[model samples]
Target: MSWMEDLLLLGIGGIAVSVYGVVAGLLLLGIDRKLVARMQARIGPPIRQPFVDVQKLFTKQNIVPEHAVAWLFNGAPVVALVSSLVILLYLPIGSIPPVLSGYGDLILIMYLLTIPALALVAGGFSSGSPYATVGAQREMVTMISYELPLAIVFIAIAWRMSADGIGDPFSLVTIMQYPLWGLVGPLGLIGGLILLFILLLVTPAELSRIPFDTPEAETELAGGLLVEYSGKNLAMFYTAQGVKTLVMASILIALFLPWNPSGLLGLGGILAAGIDIAFFLLKLVVVVFASVTLVRAMVARFRITQVVGMYWLFLGLMGIIALILLGIDAIGGA
Candidate 1:
């Protein structure tokens, strides 16, 4: 195809992916709420509650605090939502490939992941509320805390793949083609599980969900980073939150659990793809349950100190141990 056709196709694909990301992301968020409530022995709002909440917020009057920097306070939500959607285009959906694939995908995602949180910090600071400021500071600190363990998990996996002569080990396509579980021995298997465990723990902090929700501790900060937000802007942030939850879950599925039962069942062609896609969505449900909903139901919000200690100190150490085991396994196999 010519460059013009490519561009047109790309544009169409981008729009399609964005729509899917928004809808699927919101649905997952609502499902998470329902599951968390059930786990807590309370009847939660309907699965469509997130959709309703977003719609209601869109219709409300958007308020800007008089003391706030009007420009950034307004712009942050737009950036957060758009960037989160951008991430979806780079991810594979079941048997479908990424809309935009390249060698630098993981690196690109690593950078893109930071943008939403940075936007949150900007929005918080721009709002000029003491609560928002504190929340923003906490958000930044939390971001720093999680990066070490997150890096160890991805890098260890990619590095192991490279050692086995896999090309472009950092590529999601490549990783999916050669899952770590298939490549590892007993030692490596244990290490891979530990890394998976680390990643699962990291998920809550990435989403700013419970146990890591100090940034938005409503009980204390009265919504903290979002204290001054309302109406359309707040709706955008809320939707972005859901989209980001999808992003994290998708990444987790891509990394440690990119399996489909189609192969086991001897499926092929469109039917196989369909089955795989359905299975991929099911994996999303299980992963979101394990990483977000289960944690939310079981764990209370961690103080900033606890957040730092948990991610940087505890998880960080475990990540290193896992990486060491993978290295030893590689050596023994060689």
Candidate 2:
């Protein structure tokens, strides 16, 4: 494709992914409300409730704290939105992400994922609100806890792919074509399953959902890091949140559902793409439902220390074992 063609596709694909994020995130929130209602045996708001909430937030007046840094306080939400959107641009949504895949190393995606969290921390610190400051601290702590296991999980996958003798292409596009899961060798499958569980655990925390929502613990911090935001500023944060939710889910899919959409494996293009997209979204929803909704219901919020301990002790150990297993399997194959 020509440079202009690539640029156009990138713009269109990026916008499509952003729109999907908005729609899917809102739907997931509504689904959570309904699911919770079902679990609690109570009525729930309409599926449109999240949309209504965002609209109301937008209509609210913007509030700036006298003690807040005016520039950063105003710029925070934009930073979040841009960071999250840039991540979406790097990811493969319904089909693929353009303009980023040539250099779309998994490590690059990892760095992009950190951007929103860093932006949130900066925004919170600049707000000069006690709640915001506390939230920022919690966010940093949570990032420290989860990042190790998440990195291990990605590295394990890449390591496994290299062991398969695919010549070390760590881009999602390359890994997507390999049938690592199809190996299903006892140790490899076991390790992959363990890593998948760890990834699922990290997903909600990364997205700041229920149990790991310490950064925005509303009951305790009165909206936590966002306590001081209002109007358009709040709207940007809200939208970035929606985008981030989709980004996390998409990453899960890309890592786990690496099936081909172009039907290279004896399947026709249209049929293969349909199967790929369907299974991809289905896997994503299942992951979201389990991690964000079911886990939230099953577990109570942990103390900060307990949260950190859980990630480092349980999830971290799991990742380490997973990598070891993959290494052993790779050696055996070699």
Candidate 3:
């Protein structure tokens, strides 16, 4: 394909993935509503309720706090939503590669992942509400706690990629396409699985889902970090959240499920794409259901202190073990 053709394909793919993100996000939320209701043995709203909720939020009146920094408060959701959209542009969807692969790297993508949280911090602090202030503190603590394990997890993956003879482990596409299972030893696989488990735990927290949702727990903090947002601003934040969840799932899929959608462009390619998408959605739903909703329903919310301890001690240990295993593998290969 010509450069122009590549750009067109890239644009089309990005748009399609964004649409998929919207659809998947809405679908997951609806499923969560129904599932939560069923888990509680209560009747839930209709499946279409998420769309209705977003519509209502958008049409609602804008409510800015008197003491708030107006510009920063207003800009928060825009930054969040735009960062999520940028992530989508960097992801490969099905048979399509990223629009700007030249600008993409796993490390870069990981850093970009922090933008939404930073946006939340700005929005929360600017609100000047007591609830928002408290939520902001919790958000910061959570970020600090989980980030260490997350960084170790990525480093372990990159190390495994290097061991595989994939030329620069930092290259997103290069590491992504390298067959992890083939390269890593048994111990490394075990460690990688543990690392993957930690990431799975962190994913919902990163996306502000339940259990790890102390920052926005409705019952505890009265909508918590988002108490001050309203109207289009709130809608923008909500949409950004939906996009973030999709982007997280896509990253997981890319890193772990890259083998599917085999590169042969024909019926085989179509079959590969279909199967890959099905498995991708299946895995995503399973993660959402098990880690997010199920855990939320089963366990009471953790106090901020407990959450901090949980990530730093338990998850951090797991990540270190994974890194050690990766290092051992590299030594053994050498």
Better by lDDT, candidate 3 or 1: 1
lDDT of 1 by residue, 126-211 (tens): 99999999999999999999999999998999999988988899889888889999998999999999999998998889899999
Model 2, span 1-334: residue lDDT tens:
6989978977887777677777777776777777877777788888778788888988899999999998998888998888888876667754544347776778988888888898888889999999999999999999999999999988889888877777755787676667558654678888999988998899889978778999998888888788899998988898788777777888877788665445555666567667766666776677677778788777777777878999999999989998888777777766
Clash count for each candidate, listed in order shown: 0, 0, 0
Q: What TM-score, over all chains together, does every model reach?
A: 0.98, 0.92, 0.90
Comparing 1 and 2 on lDDT, the stronger one:
1
* 1 against 3, candidate with superior TM-score: 1
Estimate the overall C-alpha local distance difference test score of candidate 1: 0.92
Candidate 3, overall lDDT?
0.79
lDDT of 2: 0.80
Candidate closest to the true structure, highest TM-score = 1
lDDT of 3 at 127: 94
